[model samples]
Target: MSIRKLAVLLVLGGMAAIPALAHGPHSLESMAMPGATKTTSSSRATVSPAQLKPGKPQAMLIFVRDGRGRPVERFALQHEKLMHLIVVSDDLTFFDHLHPQYVGGGRFRVTANLPASGSYTAFADYLPQGGSPQVSALHLQAGSGSTASVPLTPDSPLSKRAGDLTVTLKLDSGSIAPGRQTPLTFFIKDGNGNPVTDLQPYLGAMGHLVVIRQSPVLTAADYLHAHPEDQGGHSMGAMAEMHHTHGERQQMAGMDQMAASQKAEPGSVSFKTVFPGPGTYRLWAQFQRNGKIITADYTIAV
Candidate 1:
Protein backbone atom coordinates (compact mmCIF):
# COMPACT_ATOMS: atom_id res chain seq x y z
CA MET A 1 0.00 0.00 0.00
CA SER A 2 1.08 3.59 -0.50
CA ILE A 3 2.73 5.38 2.46
CA ARG A 4 -0.16 7.80 2.68
CA LYS A 5 -2.63 4.97 2.98
CA LEU A 6 -0.47 3.32 5.60
CA ALA A 7 -0.19 6.58 7.53
CA VAL A 8 -3.98 6.83 7.63
CA LEU A 9 -4.17 3.36 9.08
CA LEU A 10 -1.49 4.17 11.69
CA VAL A 11 -3.33 7.30 12.84
CA LEU A 12 -6.63 5.40 13.07
CA GLY A 13 -4.96 2.67 15.03
CA GLY A 14 -3.36 5.14 17.43
CA MET A 15 -6.69 6.86 18.04
CA ALA A 16 -8.38 3.53 18.72
CA ALA A 17 -5.67 2.51 21.16
CA ILE A 18 -5.63 5.84 22.98
CA PRO A 19 -8.08 4.62 25.58
CA ALA A 20 -5.97 1.59 26.33
CA LEU A 21 -2.74 3.55 26.68
CA ALA A 22 -1.80 5.58 29.72
CA HIS A 23 -2.05 9.34 29.51
CA GLY A 24 0.82 10.41 27.27
CA PRO A 25 3.40 13.02 28.23
CA HIS A 26 2.27 15.55 25.63
CA SER A 27 -0.82 16.47 23.60
CA LEU A 28 -1.56 16.67 19.90
CA GLU A 29 -3.02 19.69 18.03
CA SER A 30 -3.46 21.06 14.56
CA MET A 31 -1.06 23.75 13.36
CA ALA A 32 -2.70 25.45 10.38
CA MET A 33 -0.24 25.99 7.55
CA PRO A 34 -0.84 26.52 3.88
CA GLY A 35 -0.91 23.26 1.87
CA ALA A 36 -0.53 21.26 5.06
CA THR A 37 -2.80 20.32 7.91
CA LYS A 38 -0.30 19.56 10.69
CA THR A 39 -1.26 17.62 13.83
CA THR A 40 1.32 17.17 16.62
CA SER A 41 1.42 14.26 19.07
CA SER A 42 2.73 15.66 22.35
CA SER A 43 3.75 12.27 23.64
CA ARG A 44 7.56 12.37 23.71
CA ALA A 45 9.60 9.41 22.47
CA THR A 46 12.88 9.14 24.37
CA VAL A 47 16.28 7.91 23.21
CA SER A 48 18.34 6.62 26.09
CA PRO A 49 21.68 8.24 26.93
CA ALA A 50 23.51 5.00 26.08
CA GLN A 51 22.19 5.24 22.54
CA LEU A 52 23.74 8.71 22.23
CA LYS A 53 27.38 9.76 22.58
CA PRO A 54 28.74 13.18 23.46
CA GLY A 55 31.45 15.39 21.81
CA LYS A 56 31.02 13.85 18.37
CA PRO A 57 28.78 14.33 15.36
CA GLN A 58 26.23 11.58 15.76
CA ALA A 59 23.70 10.34 13.28
CA MET A 60 20.12 10.10 14.47
CA LEU A 61 18.18 7.50 12.57
CA ILE A 62 14.41 7.48 12.18
CA PHE A 63 12.07 5.05 10.54
CA VAL A 64 8.61 6.01 9.32
CA ARG A 65 6.40 2.98 9.73
CA ASP A 66 2.75 1.99 9.71
CA GLY A 67 0.73 0.58 12.59
CA ARG A 68 2.11 -2.80 11.61
CA GLY A 69 5.71 -1.55 12.07
CA ARG A 70 6.39 -1.55 8.37
CA PRO A 71 8.26 1.21 6.58
CA VAL A 72 6.42 4.08 4.89
CA GLU A 73 7.83 5.31 1.57
CA ARG A 74 5.28 7.59 -0.06
CA PHE A 75 2.86 10.23 1.19
CA ALA A 76 1.36 13.65 0.41
CA LEU A 77 -1.68 11.84 -1.08
CA GLN A 78 0.45 11.39 -4.20
CA HIS A 79 3.34 9.34 -2.81
CA GLU A 80 5.51 12.34 -2.04
CA LYS A 81 8.53 12.05 0.28
CA LEU A 82 7.67 9.88 3.23
CA MET A 83 8.94 12.22 5.96
CA HIS A 84 10.25 15.66 6.86
CA LEU A 85 12.44 15.67 9.96
CA ILE A 86 12.96 18.80 12.09
CA VAL A 87 15.46 18.54 14.99
CA VAL A 88 15.77 21.04 17.85
CA SER A 89 17.36 21.03 21.29
CA ASP A 90 15.55 21.56 24.61
CA ASP A 91 16.79 25.12 25.08
CA LEU A 92 15.72 26.33 21.64
CA THR A 93 19.35 26.50 20.61
CA PHE A 94 19.50 24.58 17.35
CA PHE A 95 17.00 24.47 14.48
CA ASP A 96 17.35 22.18 11.47
CA HIS A 97 14.50 21.58 9.03
CA LEU A 98 15.93 18.63 7.13
CA HIS A 99 14.55 16.40 4.41
CA PRO A 100 16.48 13.30 5.24
CA GLN A 101 18.01 11.40 2.36
CA TYR A 102 16.11 8.17 2.49
CA VAL A 103 18.23 5.15 3.32
CA GLY A 104 17.07 1.82 2.02
CA GLY A 105 14.57 -0.31 4.01
CA GLY A 106 12.47 2.64 5.21
CA ARG A 107 15.17 4.14 7.48
CA PHE A 108 16.23 7.80 7.38
CA ARG A 109 19.52 9.03 8.81
CA VAL A 110 20.96 12.51 9.27
CA THR A 111 24.28 13.72 10.65
CA ALA A 112 23.78 15.58 13.97
CA ASN A 113 26.74 16.89 15.94
CA LEU A 114 25.64 17.57 19.52
CA PRO A 115 27.64 20.41 21.12
CA ALA A 116 27.00 19.80 24.81
CA SER A 117 25.69 17.23 27.21
CA GLY A 118 21.93 17.71 27.59
CA SER A 119 18.50 16.58 26.45
CA TYR A 120 17.23 17.26 22.94
CA THR A 121 13.87 16.90 21.21
CA ALA A 122 13.31 15.81 17.63
CA PHE A 123 10.12 16.42 15.64
CA ALA A 124 9.14 14.20 12.73
CA ASP A 125 6.50 15.65 10.40
CA TYR A 126 4.85 13.33 7.92
CA LEU A 127 1.55 12.60 6.22
CA PRO A 128 -0.19 9.43 7.23
CA GLN A 129 -1.94 7.74 4.36
CA GLY A 130 -5.08 9.65 3.39
CA GLY A 131 -4.74 11.86 6.49
CA SER A 132 -3.38 15.27 7.45
CA PRO A 133 0.28 15.88 8.33
CA GLN A 134 1.32 14.81 11.84
CA VAL A 135 4.23 15.76 14.15
CA SER A 136 5.78 13.65 16.90
CA ALA A 137 8.40 14.67 19.51
CA LEU A 138 11.36 12.44 20.47
CA HIS A 139 13.76 13.19 23.34
CA LEU A 140 17.44 12.22 23.20
CA GLN A 141 20.06 12.88 25.85
CA ALA A 142 23.68 13.61 25.06
CA GLY A 143 26.93 14.49 26.95
CA SER A 144 27.44 14.42 30.71
CA GLY A 145 27.08 17.40 33.02
CA SER A 146 24.73 18.87 35.55
CA THR A 147 22.33 21.63 34.52
CA ALA A 148 23.06 25.12 35.85
CA SER A 149 21.32 26.38 38.98
CA VAL A 150 21.76 30.15 38.51
CA PRO A 151 18.44 31.93 38.79
CA LEU A 152 17.06 34.36 36.24
CA THR A 153 15.23 37.42 37.46
CA PRO A 154 11.55 36.91 36.67
CA ASP A 155 10.24 39.29 33.97
CA SER A 156 13.72 40.43 33.02
CA PRO A 157 13.58 42.25 29.72
CA LEU A 158 15.68 40.46 27.08
CA SER A 159 14.83 42.21 23.84
CA LYS A 160 12.18 44.30 22.08
CA ARG A 161 11.08 45.23 18.58
CA ALA A 162 8.99 47.92 16.86
CA GLY A 163 6.13 45.51 16.12
CA ASP A 164 4.58 46.23 19.50
CA LEU A 165 5.74 42.82 20.75
CA THR A 166 8.15 42.77 23.70
CA VAL A 167 10.12 39.63 24.66
CA THR A 168 11.35 38.78 28.14
CA LEU A 169 13.06 35.78 29.77
CA LYS A 170 12.18 34.62 33.28
CA LEU A 171 12.59 31.57 35.48
CA ASP A 172 10.18 29.98 37.95
CA SER A 173 12.84 30.15 40.64
CA GLY A 174 15.91 32.23 41.25
CA SER A 175 17.95 29.03 40.84
CA ILE A 176 17.50 25.71 38.97
CA ALA A 177 19.34 22.41 39.45
CA PRO A 178 19.82 19.55 37.03
CA GLY A 179 16.88 17.19 36.38
CA ARG A 180 14.61 19.66 38.14
CA GLN A 181 11.62 21.22 36.40
CA THR A 182 11.92 24.97 35.92
CA PRO A 183 9.13 27.16 34.71
CA LEU A 184 9.83 29.56 31.82
CA THR A 185 7.29 32.11 30.66
CA PHE A 186 6.91 34.09 27.41
CA PHE A 187 4.46 36.97 27.65
CA ILE A 188 3.25 38.38 24.35
CA LYS A 189 0.87 41.23 23.52
CA ASP A 190 -0.19 43.37 20.59
CA GLY A 191 0.48 47.08 20.27
CA ASN A 192 -2.66 47.57 22.37
CA GLY A 193 -0.96 45.83 25.33
CA ASN A 194 -3.56 43.05 25.37
CA PRO A 195 -2.85 39.32 25.40
CA VAL A 196 -2.88 37.98 21.84
CA THR A 197 -5.58 35.38 22.45
CA ASP A 198 -5.97 34.78 18.74
CA LEU A 199 -2.52 33.16 18.83
CA GLN A 200 -2.87 30.55 16.06
CA PRO A 201 -1.26 27.14 16.43
CA TYR A 202 2.08 26.92 14.65
CA LEU A 203 3.54 23.53 13.66
CA GLY A 204 0.80 21.66 15.53
CA ALA A 205 1.10 23.59 18.79
CA MET A 206 0.28 27.07 20.04
CA GLY A 207 3.96 27.62 19.28
CA HIS A 208 7.20 25.79 18.55
CA LEU A 209 10.15 26.34 20.94
CA VAL A 210 13.66 25.28 19.86
CA VAL A 211 16.67 25.53 22.20
CA ILE A 212 20.31 24.94 21.35
CA ARG A 213 23.60 25.10 23.28
CA GLN A 214 25.63 27.98 21.97
CA SER A 215 28.64 27.17 19.80
CA PRO A 216 30.85 29.30 17.56
CA VAL A 217 28.81 27.75 14.73
CA LEU A 218 25.52 25.86 14.88
CA THR A 219 25.91 22.08 14.82
CA ALA A 220 23.90 19.07 15.82
CA ALA A 221 26.80 18.47 18.21
CA ASP A 222 25.53 21.54 20.04
CA TYR A 223 22.81 20.33 22.36
CA LEU A 224 19.39 20.72 20.69
CA HIS A 225 15.88 20.59 22.16
CA ALA A 226 12.41 21.20 20.77
CA HIS A 227 9.03 21.18 22.54
CA PRO A 228 5.51 22.65 22.51
CA GLU A 229 4.85 24.38 25.82
CA ASP A 230 1.29 25.01 27.05
CA GLN A 231 -0.75 27.76 25.44
CA GLY A 232 -2.19 29.45 28.57
CA GLY A 233 1.21 30.66 29.86
CA HIS A 234 1.70 27.58 32.00
CA SER A 235 4.93 25.57 32.23
CA MET A 236 5.63 22.50 30.07
CA GLY A 237 4.33 20.10 32.71
CA ALA A 238 0.71 20.69 31.77
CA MET A 239 1.42 19.86 28.15
CA ALA A 240 0.04 16.32 28.49
CA GLU A 241 -3.41 17.37 29.66
CA MET A 242 -3.72 20.08 27.04
CA HIS A 243 -4.85 17.66 24.33
CA HIS A 244 -8.35 17.12 25.72
CA THR A 245 -9.29 20.78 25.91
CA HIS A 246 -12.09 22.05 23.65
CA GLY A 247 -9.87 24.73 22.18
CA GLU A 248 -7.27 22.18 21.11
CA ARG A 249 -9.82 19.93 19.42
CA GLN A 250 -11.35 22.81 17.53
CA GLN A 251 -7.93 24.02 16.49
CA MET A 252 -6.92 20.58 15.25
CA ALA A 253 -10.05 20.32 13.11
CA GLY A 254 -9.49 23.80 11.75
CA MET A 255 -5.89 22.98 10.80
CA ASP A 256 -6.87 19.87 8.86
CA GLN A 257 -9.50 21.75 6.89
CA MET A 258 -7.17 24.67 6.29
CA ALA A 259 -4.45 22.39 4.92
CA ALA A 260 -6.87 20.47 2.71
CA SER A 261 -7.86 23.80 1.21
CA GLN A 262 -4.27 25.14 0.95
CA LYS A 263 -4.15 28.67 2.36
CA ALA A 264 -1.18 30.91 3.22
CA GLU A 265 -0.71 33.58 5.89
CA PRO A 266 1.51 36.62 6.35
CA GLY A 267 3.77 37.99 9.12
CA SER A 268 5.90 36.35 11.84
CA VAL A 269 5.51 35.10 15.44
CA SER A 270 8.10 35.08 18.26
CA PHE A 271 8.52 33.66 21.82
CA LYS A 272 11.18 32.97 24.53
CA THR A 273 12.68 29.92 26.31
CA VAL A 274 15.12 28.95 29.12
CA PHE A 275 18.13 26.62 29.00
CA PRO A 276 19.04 23.97 31.54
CA GLY A 277 22.70 24.92 31.63
CA PRO A 278 24.76 28.05 32.35
CA GLY A 279 26.11 28.36 28.81
CA THR A 280 24.87 30.54 25.98
CA TYR A 281 21.89 29.34 23.92
CA ARG A 282 19.67 30.38 21.00
CA LEU A 283 15.93 30.15 20.40
CA TRP A 284 13.57 30.20 17.43
CA ALA A 285 9.80 30.58 17.66
CA GLN A 286 7.59 30.08 14.59
CA PHE A 287 4.02 31.30 14.27
CA GLN A 288 1.43 32.41 11.74
CA ARG A 289 -0.78 35.48 11.63
CA ASN A 290 -2.94 36.81 8.78
CA GLY A 291 -1.70 33.99 6.57
CA LYS A 292 1.96 34.85 6.98
CA ILE A 293 4.68 32.63 8.45
CA ILE A 294 6.78 34.57 10.96
CA THR A 295 10.04 33.28 12.49
CA ALA A 296 11.94 35.27 15.13
CA ASP A 297 15.19 34.27 16.84
CA TYR A 298 17.20 35.37 19.87
CA THR A 299 20.37 34.43 21.73
CA ILE A 300 20.72 34.52 25.52
CA ALA A 301 23.17 33.55 28.26
CA VAL A 302 21.99 31.46 31.16
Candidate 2:
Protein backbone atom coordinates (compact mmCIF):
# COMPACT_ATOMS: atom_id res chain seq x y z
CA MET A 1 0.00 0.00 0.00
CA SER A 2 1.02 3.62 -0.58
CA ILE A 3 2.27 5.71 2.36
CA ARG A 4 -0.87 7.89 2.45
CA LYS A 5 -3.14 4.86 2.38
CA LEU A 6 -1.13 3.25 5.18
CA ALA A 7 -1.50 6.33 7.36
CA VAL A 8 -5.25 6.39 6.80
CA LEU A 9 -5.53 2.75 7.81
CA LEU A 10 -3.68 3.43 11.09
CA VAL A 11 -5.95 6.34 11.99
CA LEU A 12 -9.08 4.40 11.13
CA GLY A 13 -7.92 1.47 13.18
CA GLY A 14 -7.34 3.67 16.23
CA MET A 15 -10.77 5.26 15.97
CA ALA A 16 -12.42 1.90 15.64
CA ALA A 17 -10.60 0.53 18.69
CA ILE A 18 -11.71 3.26 21.11
CA PRO A 19 -15.07 1.83 22.09
CA ALA A 20 -13.71 -1.65 22.73
CA LEU A 21 -11.31 -0.07 25.24
CA ALA A 22 -13.71 2.36 26.92
CA HIS A 23 -12.06 2.98 30.29
CA GLY A 24 -10.08 5.71 32.04
CA PRO A 25 -6.62 5.82 33.62
CA HIS A 26 -5.25 3.10 35.89
CA SER A 27 -5.40 3.16 39.71
CA LEU A 28 -2.50 4.45 41.84
CA GLU A 29 -2.02 1.09 43.56
CA SER A 30 -1.26 -0.70 40.30
CA MET A 31 1.02 2.18 39.33
CA ALA A 32 3.37 1.44 42.25
CA MET A 33 2.95 4.43 44.58
CA PRO A 34 5.59 5.01 47.25
CA GLY A 35 4.81 4.03 50.88
CA ALA A 36 1.83 2.13 49.52
CA THR A 37 1.32 -1.49 50.39
CA LYS A 38 -0.02 -3.92 47.84
CA THR A 39 -3.41 -2.56 46.71
CA THR A 40 -6.19 -5.05 46.07
CA SER A 41 -8.46 -4.27 43.13
CA SER A 42 -11.48 -6.35 44.08
CA SER A 43 -13.66 -3.38 45.01
CA ARG A 44 -15.63 -1.55 42.28
CA ALA A 45 -17.51 1.72 41.64
CA THR A 46 -20.68 1.72 39.55
CA VAL A 47 -22.92 4.35 37.93
CA SER A 48 -26.68 4.12 37.67
CA PRO A 49 -28.36 4.06 34.22
CA ALA A 50 -24.90 3.36 32.68
CA GLN A 51 -25.06 6.84 31.11
CA LEU A 52 -25.82 10.47 31.86
CA LYS A 53 -28.78 12.25 30.31
CA PRO A 54 -27.86 15.83 29.46
CA GLY A 55 -30.68 17.43 31.46
CA LYS A 56 -30.81 15.05 34.43
CA PRO A 57 -28.64 14.50 37.46
CA GLN A 58 -26.57 11.29 37.31
CA ALA A 59 -26.04 9.21 40.41
CA MET A 60 -22.74 7.39 41.06
CA LEU A 61 -22.52 4.41 43.41
CA ILE A 62 -19.31 3.18 44.99
CA PHE A 63 -18.63 0.00 47.01
CA VAL A 64 -15.28 -0.51 48.73
CA ARG A 65 -14.10 -4.05 49.36
CA ASP A 66 -10.82 -5.81 50.00
CA GLY A 67 -9.33 -8.74 48.10
CA ARG A 68 -11.83 -10.81 49.99
CA GLY A 69 -15.54 -10.56 49.13
CA ARG A 70 -16.42 -8.39 52.12
CA PRO A 71 -17.67 -4.82 51.95
CA VAL A 72 -15.55 -2.03 53.49
CA GLU A 73 -17.42 0.69 55.40
CA ARG A 74 -14.84 3.15 56.72
CA PHE A 75 -12.78 5.49 54.57
CA ALA A 76 -10.23 8.05 55.79
CA LEU A 77 -10.68 11.71 54.91
CA GLN A 78 -8.13 13.27 52.58
CA HIS A 79 -7.84 16.95 51.58
CA GLU A 80 -10.77 17.69 53.86
CA LYS A 81 -13.05 15.64 51.64
CA LEU A 82 -14.38 12.13 51.99
CA MET A 83 -14.22 11.06 48.35
CA HIS A 84 -13.07 12.88 45.25
CA LEU A 85 -14.72 11.82 41.99
CA ILE A 86 -13.15 12.92 38.71
CA VAL A 87 -15.31 12.87 35.57
CA VAL A 88 -13.67 13.39 32.20
CA SER A 89 -15.08 12.91 28.73
CA ASP A 90 -13.37 10.35 26.56
CA ASP A 91 -12.19 13.14 24.31
CA LEU A 92 -10.39 14.76 27.23
CA THR A 93 -12.45 17.93 26.96
CA PHE A 94 -14.95 18.29 29.81
CA PHE A 95 -13.44 17.72 33.27
CA ASP A 96 -15.16 17.99 36.66
CA HIS A 97 -13.89 17.21 40.16
CA LEU A 98 -16.67 16.25 42.55
CA HIS A 99 -17.01 15.14 46.16
CA PRO A 100 -19.51 12.43 47.12
CA GLN A 101 -21.09 11.74 50.52
CA TYR A 102 -20.81 8.40 52.33
CA VAL A 103 -24.37 7.25 52.89
CA GLY A 104 -23.54 4.13 54.95
CA GLY A 105 -22.83 0.39 54.59
CA GLY A 106 -19.82 0.89 52.33
CA ARG A 107 -21.92 2.83 49.85
CA PHE A 108 -21.41 6.43 48.58
CA ARG A 109 -23.78 8.45 46.45
CA VAL A 110 -22.90 11.36 44.14
CA THR A 111 -25.42 13.32 42.09
CA ALA A 112 -23.73 15.19 39.23
CA ASN A 113 -25.01 17.17 36.28
CA LEU A 114 -23.19 16.55 33.05
CA PRO A 115 -22.97 19.27 30.43
CA ALA A 116 -23.18 17.26 27.24
CA SER A 117 -23.66 13.82 25.73
CA GLY A 118 -20.52 11.85 25.17
CA SER A 119 -18.36 8.98 26.45
CA TYR A 120 -16.90 9.70 29.87
CA THR A 121 -14.95 8.10 32.70
CA ALA A 122 -15.55 8.44 36.45
CA PHE A 123 -12.68 7.75 38.84
CA ALA A 124 -13.21 7.36 42.58
CA ASP A 125 -10.08 8.32 44.54
CA TYR A 126 -10.13 7.64 48.27
CA LEU A 127 -8.28 6.06 51.18
CA PRO A 128 -10.01 3.11 52.82
CA GLN A 129 -9.84 3.00 56.60
CA GLY A 130 -6.56 1.32 57.65
CA GLY A 131 -5.90 0.30 54.05
CA SER A 132 -4.07 1.59 50.98
CA PRO A 133 -5.51 4.36 48.84
CA GLN A 134 -8.00 3.17 46.24
CA VAL A 135 -8.77 4.58 42.78
CA SER A 136 -11.73 2.87 41.10
CA ALA A 137 -13.23 3.69 37.72
CA LEU A 138 -16.59 3.32 35.95
CA HIS A 139 -17.27 3.89 32.26
CA LEU A 140 -20.17 6.15 31.35
CA GLN A 141 -22.06 6.92 28.13
CA ALA A 142 -24.13 10.05 27.67
CA GLY A 143 -26.99 10.54 25.22
CA SER A 144 -26.37 9.78 21.55
CA GLY A 145 -24.19 12.76 20.69
CA SER A 146 -20.67 12.27 19.47
CA THR A 147 -17.70 13.55 21.46
CA ALA A 148 -15.70 16.49 20.14
CA SER A 149 -12.11 16.18 19.05
CA VAL A 150 -9.29 17.75 21.06
CA PRO A 151 -9.08 21.50 20.45
CA LEU A 152 -6.09 22.85 18.62
CA THR A 153 -4.68 26.35 19.16
CA PRO A 154 -2.80 28.23 16.42
CA ASP A 155 0.48 27.82 18.30
CA SER A 156 1.29 25.88 21.47
CA PRO A 157 0.89 28.59 24.09
CA LEU A 158 3.54 28.63 26.79
CA SER A 159 1.68 31.24 28.82
CA LYS A 160 -1.95 32.33 29.15
CA ARG A 161 -3.00 35.87 29.98
CA ALA A 162 -5.95 36.74 32.21
CA GLY A 163 -6.59 40.39 33.07
CA ASP A 164 -3.44 41.76 34.73
CA LEU A 165 -1.75 38.43 35.40
CA THR A 166 0.00 35.91 33.14
CA VAL A 167 0.53 32.26 33.99
CA THR A 168 3.35 30.44 32.22
CA LEU A 169 4.62 26.87 32.47
CA LYS A 170 8.31 26.44 33.31
CA LEU A 171 10.38 23.32 32.88
CA ASP A 172 13.98 22.21 32.77
CA SER A 173 13.48 21.29 29.11
CA GLY A 174 10.79 21.54 26.48
CA SER A 175 11.00 17.88 25.46
CA ILE A 176 9.57 15.17 27.78
CA ALA A 177 10.66 11.54 27.60
CA PRO A 178 8.84 8.39 28.58
CA GLY A 179 9.76 6.54 31.79
CA ARG A 180 11.60 9.62 33.15
CA GLN A 181 10.58 12.24 35.70
CA THR A 182 10.20 15.77 34.34
CA PRO A 183 10.04 18.78 36.61
CA LEU A 184 7.02 20.94 35.72
CA THR A 185 6.67 24.47 37.17
CA PHE A 186 4.40 27.46 36.76
CA PHE A 187 4.91 31.17 37.44
CA ILE A 188 2.74 34.27 37.40
CA LYS A 189 3.45 37.86 36.30
CA ASP A 190 1.79 41.13 37.13
CA GLY A 191 0.29 43.66 34.76
CA ASN A 192 3.76 45.06 34.24
CA GLY A 193 4.93 41.70 32.86
CA ASN A 194 7.15 41.01 35.90
CA PRO A 195 7.07 38.00 38.22
CA VAL A 196 4.56 38.87 40.92
CA THR A 197 5.57 38.61 44.58
CA ASP A 198 1.98 38.89 45.84
CA LEU A 199 1.22 35.20 45.22
CA GLN A 200 -0.62 33.72 48.17
CA PRO A 201 -2.52 30.64 49.23
CA TYR A 202 -5.33 29.49 46.97
CA LEU A 203 -7.66 26.74 48.18
CA GLY A 204 -5.14 26.29 51.02
CA ALA A 205 -2.27 25.52 48.61
CA MET A 206 0.27 27.44 46.56
CA GLY A 207 -0.87 26.00 43.22
CA HIS A 208 -2.35 22.88 41.65
CA LEU A 209 -1.66 20.88 38.50
CA VAL A 210 -4.03 18.31 36.97
CA VAL A 211 -2.58 16.03 34.30
CA ILE A 212 -4.69 14.13 31.76
CA ARG A 213 -3.80 12.24 28.65
CA GLN A 214 -5.17 13.39 25.32
CA SER A 215 -4.75 9.92 23.83
CA PRO A 216 -4.34 7.20 26.41
CA VAL A 217 -1.72 4.55 25.68
CA LEU A 218 -1.74 2.96 29.10
CA THR A 219 -4.96 1.19 30.04
CA ALA A 220 -4.03 0.67 33.69
CA ALA A 221 -3.33 4.28 34.77
CA ASP A 222 -4.00 7.00 32.22
CA TYR A 223 -3.92 10.23 34.29
CA LEU A 224 -1.81 11.95 36.98
CA HIS A 225 -4.30 12.97 39.73
CA ALA A 226 -2.49 14.89 42.46
CA HIS A 227 -2.76 18.11 44.53
CA PRO A 228 0.81 18.72 45.73
CA GLU A 229 0.70 16.14 48.51
CA ASP A 230 0.54 12.47 49.47
CA GLN A 231 -3.22 12.32 49.64
CA GLY A 232 -3.17 10.06 46.62
CA GLY A 233 0.35 8.79 47.10
CA HIS A 234 4.00 9.94 47.26
CA SER A 235 3.80 11.43 43.76
CA MET A 236 4.34 14.92 45.18
CA GLY A 237 7.61 14.03 46.88
CA ALA A 238 9.28 13.80 43.49
CA MET A 239 7.45 16.93 42.39
CA ALA A 240 8.64 18.86 45.47
CA GLU A 241 12.30 18.01 44.96
CA MET A 242 12.11 19.27 41.40
CA HIS A 243 11.66 22.83 42.79
CA HIS A 244 15.04 23.06 44.55
CA THR A 245 17.93 24.58 42.61
CA HIS A 246 21.26 23.22 43.84
CA GLY A 247 20.66 21.28 47.04
CA GLU A 248 18.29 18.70 45.63
CA ARG A 249 18.66 16.04 48.34
CA GLN A 250 18.58 18.60 51.15
CA GLN A 251 15.36 20.19 49.89
CA MET A 252 13.75 16.79 49.40
CA ALA A 253 14.69 15.86 52.96
CA GLY A 254 12.96 19.01 54.19
CA MET A 255 9.87 18.19 52.15
CA ASP A 256 9.45 14.97 54.13
CA GLN A 257 8.56 17.03 57.21
CA MET A 258 6.54 19.80 55.55
CA ALA A 259 2.78 19.93 55.99
CA ALA A 260 0.24 20.40 53.22
CA SER A 261 -0.85 23.78 54.66
CA GLN A 262 2.55 25.48 54.37
CA LYS A 263 2.58 28.75 52.46
CA ALA A 264 3.92 28.41 48.92
CA GLU A 265 5.35 31.20 46.78
CA PRO A 266 4.87 31.68 43.06
CA GLY A 267 6.97 29.54 40.71
CA SER A 268 7.81 27.40 43.72
CA VAL A 269 5.05 24.84 43.00
CA SER A 270 6.73 22.22 40.85
CA PHE A 271 6.02 18.54 40.21
CA LYS A 272 8.42 15.83 39.15
CA THR A 273 6.10 13.70 36.98
CA VAL A 274 6.88 10.66 34.89
CA PHE A 275 5.09 10.13 31.61
CA PRO A 276 4.30 6.46 31.10
CA GLY A 277 4.40 6.54 27.31
CA PRO A 278 4.68 8.79 24.28
CA GLY A 279 1.50 10.69 23.43
CA THR A 280 -0.15 14.10 23.50
CA TYR A 281 -1.22 15.30 26.97
CA ARG A 282 -2.77 18.42 28.45
CA LEU A 283 -1.87 20.06 31.76
CA TRP A 284 -4.19 22.47 33.52
CA ALA A 285 -2.38 24.77 35.96
CA GLN A 286 -4.45 26.58 38.60
CA PHE A 287 -3.27 29.22 41.09
CA GLN A 288 -4.49 32.15 43.14
CA ARG A 289 -3.08 35.69 42.93
CA ASN A 290 -4.42 38.88 44.41
CA GLY A 291 -7.61 37.21 45.61
CA LYS A 292 -8.31 35.71 42.20
CA ILE A 293 -7.90 32.18 40.92
CA ILE A 294 -6.36 31.93 37.48
CA THR A 295 -6.48 28.78 35.37
CA ALA A 296 -4.15 28.21 32.43
CA ASP A 297 -3.90 25.33 29.95
CA TYR A 298 -0.73 24.01 28.37
CA THR A 299 -0.12 21.06 26.00
CA ILE A 300 2.96 18.84 25.94
CA ALA A 301 4.16 15.92 23.80
CA VAL A 302 6.08 13.00 25.22
- What is the C-alpha local distance difference test score of each model? 0.43, 0.53
TM-score of each model, paired residue for residue: 0.40, 0.67
lDDT of 1 by residue, 77-191 (tens): 1112355555654555455655555564545666666567765545565554444455654444566552232332322344444245544434444544433454444455567
Candidate 2 per-residue lDDT over residues 1-302, each given as its tens digit: 11111100001101211111113564432332211112124332223345457757756555544444345667665544567777677676677777888877666767777678776666666666554455555555677765655653322557777667777777655557888877776667777877776555543345566676664222225667544543233455344334322223433333441443234443445555788777777677766667777767677776
Ten contiguous residues minimizing lDDT sum, candidate 2: 4-13
Q: Candidate 2: list runs displaced more than 4 Å.
A: 1-46, 55-59, 148-155, 162-164, 198-204, 216-220, 229-235, 238-268, 289-293
Off by over 4 Å in 1: 1-156, 162-164, 215-277
Instruction: Give the best candidate by lDDT.
Output: 2
Error of 1 at 170 (Å): 3.3
